[model samples]
Target: MALYEFRCRECGSTFEVDRPMQRSSDPADCPDGHSDTVKLLSTVGLGGRARTATRPVRPPSPFSGGGPPPMGGGGGGCCGGGGCG
Candidate 1:
């Protein structure tokens, strides 16, 4: 969908219209049924909603044994890399 802004010459009122890009040549009328309208150039719209296709990969945390904790919490052990437990 595409957004377009227009001003009515007959009523001096501004309005917006949504239409497909392929049907751009279609005429727009004012709310009071006036075909005498002017298409206004808008600068604020950023088009339709978009989203990223890929998610970011997060590395394992140190508390899970990926690496040593930043502030040091757990003691080294057999289950956690210490030999005697």
Candidate 2:
């Protein structure tokens, strides 16, 4: 069984239901006893994660060292003498 989302037109309330895929598109009555009900868009569940073919890759960060390189003079301390190295 799959979980589906629904919206009640008469009560303007949204709810979820668990049902088979075949009945996923069927109109369901509001639990509040209203006749005006409509099926909302469905979203893929956690089970869909197993269907992914490849893992997404992320780019490397440029400042992994936490500070910029030293200036021209090797002995010269960084800008404000703040030990960024």
The best candidate by TM-score is 2
- lDDT tens per residue, model 2, 18-42: 9998887787888998878887765
Q: State in Å the error of residue 52, model 1.
A: 30
The list of candidate 2 runs beyond 4 A from truth reads 44-85
lDDT against true structure, model 2: 0.70
The residue ranges of model 1 lying beyond 4 angstroms of the native Cα positions read 46-85
- Candidate 2 versus the native: TM-score? 0.50
How accurate locally, in lDDT, is each candidate?
Answer: 0.76, 0.70
Cα deviation at 51, candidate 2, in Å, is 17
lDDT measured at residue 2 in model 1 versus the true structure, 0 to 100: 87
Give all candidate RMSDs, comma-separated.
7.2, 8.6
Number of residue pairs clashing in candidate 2, backbone atoms closer than 3 angstroms, sequence gap of 3 or more or interchain: 0
Models 1 onward score TM values of: 0.49, 0.50
